[model samples]
Target: MTPTVSGSRLKSTVAALAADRFAGRRVGTPGGRAAGRWLAGQLRAIGASVTTDEFPVAGVRELYRTPEFAWSAGSTHRRGVHRRNFAEHLVSADLPAPRTGELAVADSDEWRAKWVLAPDLGVAARARFEGAAGLLVPRGTDAEGWMPKMIAGPPVGALPVIAVRTGLHDEMARAGSGTVTASMPLRTVEVIGSNVHGVLREPAAGSPGVLLTAHFDGVGDDPQQRLPAAADNASGVAVVLEAARLLAPLLPDHVGLAASLLDGEEAGARGAAHHAPNVRSGTYVLNVDGAAQLGDGAAVEAGGPAHDLLAALDQTGRETGVPLRAGAMPSDNRRYAAAGLPAIGIGMGMPGYQTPAETADRVETATLVAATRLVVATVLRLAVHSRGLIALPHKDELQREG
Candidate 1:
């Protein structure tokens, strides 16, 4: 008999991961370490053997303080709210204190010691205004008018670059003559990240194993606001934990089952990249990234040799009534796939992705339950099929998986 997934348990897990106590669970922070410990304890509580893998990561982004921003046009001063009106660009130079300067329009010749406002920021613009105080680059916002946060990107630029909402950016660019003050206490640091692994069962000799994964780290909360990160990954972690809890006893004898709660996924999936090389051969990987909403269908991206595994997922979705579709999921699964393992990445939907508005209350319990059920069912099929208890689907049977 199949074990049932508990929605209430999933909610509690998400709340614990997204709570203020963890401070957004950024990789390499005390909060992140505490979160990893908590997850290890959870796995142990379920009677699984838990172990952690540590890896060194360089150049992780850290924001020490809330940045201040404002602009003035003929005494009409306006202070832009962080996240709502503007955000720090990943390539921005460090500026702890606000720097004020006159605003220079796009066609202005006097670019020295001024804030250049342009429709877009480019290498040419940076070289042209190398002496300017900073740049006011216009960027688009999400439908909800929020500028998302990013930790990894290209090398820092020579001048501070701030992203303003298109409307605010255009306003500043057209104002032509104005005074602007901006600051960003952002810097890079080297840190160690951890990946928590829990073993539920080991496959019989010559049998393929299954690895379930979900990143437990967030971009971290801003100094001024609480970025709960409930949907971005806490939700996905909850689903994985719930599936592990229910799948522990029901997993077949020939099937090896384990769960990996990863860190540093927000820093360009460094943790997965570090852990992939150690995965046993002939292992099938399933990674869940977003489970807060199941709009349209769950997005699936298969990498490496996963045709048979993708067919099993497709067959599972049809039986379970959860829709699956083709979509891009650039997450940790790619790392395992690169290691010559069969890996599949799944994403549902996230509401305030990587923003201050990502609160736990917005997560849908129904979606959580659905995601857990799908994962559980798929694992049962794949693990059991490895022992010839069930026949694997033909390659032509797989479709709608990217």
Candidate 2:
């Protein structure tokens, strides 16, 4: 279940993190880390047991490394080829003496030698990545790679090699058509990072748990630039922090409310996925993200056993006159739902999402306060009143998918 909180207090909290100091809260960036720390602090102040759970992830290379390779015709291709001392590790290889060098354009076997070079990186071309030596990629050539588009790093899989300018390879070819050694020192490994938490223990015996969740990572504009996730999530983190302070003590023991500010929502759900193993059953999750702006607010409804909770929220909004609407999928709500827990997302709407315009123009302080109050009230009621499994109608979309 959820807990009851003061609206005024939550609004003030949201404003503080949205300030410039938080620096847009982009995930994995300094500003984003700072915001996460700030969120943990707020929860701790409310007397919750805060724990930052760190997980490891693979970090791709910042620059591509290509080494020159040559062979003396009929010298018999080298048995094994691999990049060493590169930024990441060599996980697996699909071909030996992988294709990467000047090769007779006509032979299929020659394609393997050419494979060492990063090709145009089309879907069909990458299929050959495993068979090549060093990829003979054209320098200054703008070609896609075989991997998801990432803002910070290189493609995650395959062996190592560098793409060089055709001129450079041509020069090498002229030097001696013999055997040229090709290699790239690439490394791949999991690095440790964390998600901090603050917990306000409910009175010893009330009900199941209610988690007020938010992800602190920000992926901002500027492919090379860090995301200043101010509105993307710093605002939401701030609100969750403040909510914890006012409502922690009031929560009954049977109804525990955890102010769970998450991490790594940016790098493909790393943090949430890590924490999933430990979450208790029968929990209710109210996730907040991209809600910093104060425009006409929105409330995302959880399809199961949480509809009455929405009604209470509607009542609170009507009473407070804060403009709160209904929205679709947001953040951590998806994770909880997948775990079979009742969950919903609530926030302020951003117009041009994923851009600077997505940020909050105003705090819409009253509306935020009203929304928090509503969630808290509903949580308490569900914790105390629902006798059996109280399943609400799943939202239209969730039902259709089911």
Candidate 3:
């Protein structure tokens, strides 16, 4: 009989991950560690031997306090709201106290503690300044006017960088020169991340085996707001768990399958980075990044030597009536691909993305069912391929070759 995933179980799992107690499951936090243990327990319940690999992650951005920013251009003065009119940037320098400086368009001038109006400071952009109080870069908001959150990016502490909404930035630009006061309570810290691996079954001799991966960490809750992170990745993890629950007992006895619930993804996929090198190059890896809102099709990105695995997924998708399209998924799957493993990343849709508006209610049950079914079917197909590709050589053919 074909295995089927329980949609109710998947939904409950998503809710558990998005619950306020997990505090958005940021790596190294109590909430994050608890989440890892909880997932390990779930795997144990599914009759899998679970183990954890600990890895160190550095330069994780933490917003200790909401920033205070106000500016004046001769006659007009405005105070901006956090995540609405302005938000923190990853490259911001630590500035806890209030800082006041004159605003000048970022250029080849000696800034000398003046705040500059610059959008992005690449290596080329950074070379143009020496000492600037901070930067006010124009940033776009989501359709709902919420600035998405990020816990990782390029290095910080070069200078305080703040992202301002386009309208406010344009106003500051039209004024030509302005005075500004801002405070950044943001800091970067080092933390340890743990990856949970569950062994569902062992591969038969010569089988390449199959691995399922998903990041369970979110960007973490805002200091004051609750960012459920139901879609960004909780949905993906839920799908993997449900797929594992359904596929373990039904897979061919010789076929090997395992699930990797990763961490530090919000801070740059450190969990996968650490886990990838230990995996063999020929292993087939399938990573689910998002499965909350499936639109017309699911996005699929193949990396490394993934032709066979991708083909299997494509065939399975067709048979299951889940559309698949080529697209980019910059998630944990890329790390596995980098290690020369056959890896593919899949994403359906993320309704609210990384903003506080990302609630559990928006995740679609149909999408979860479709995603789980797709994963289960693809694993079964790959198991068949494993058996076919690694069969014993015919005695006559072997003798003739010899």
lDDT values for all models = 0.85, 0.52, 0.86
Tens digit of lDDT per residue, candidate 1, span 18-39?
9999999999988899999999
State residue 168's C-alpha deviation in candidate 1, in Å.
0.7
TM-score of each: 0.95, 0.58, 0.91
Q: Which prediction has the highest TM-score against the true structure?
A: 1
lDDT of 3 by residue, 35-151 (tens): 999999999999889999999999999988878899988779899888888999888888898899888786626677788887566532453356678788889999999899999
Under the 3 Å rule for N, CA and C atoms, how many clashes does model 1 have?
A: 0
Model 2 residue runs over 4 Å out of place are 1-24, 59-191, 203-206, 220-226, 294-326, 351-363, 383-402
Query: Which 10 consecutive residues of model 3 have the lowest summed lDDT?
Result: 393-402
lDDT computed for candidate 3? 0.86
lDDT of 1: 0.85
Clashes of each: 0, 61, 1
lDDT of 2 by residue, 215-286 (tens): 776543332222234555666776667556645555555567787777767656667667755677766777
Show model 3 residue runs off by greater than 4 Å.
Answer: 73-75, 107-111, 122-130, 388-402
Error of 1 at 119 (Å): 2.5
Pick the winner on TM-score between candidates 2 and 3.
3
If both were scored by lDDT, which would come out higher, candidate 1 or candidate 2?
1
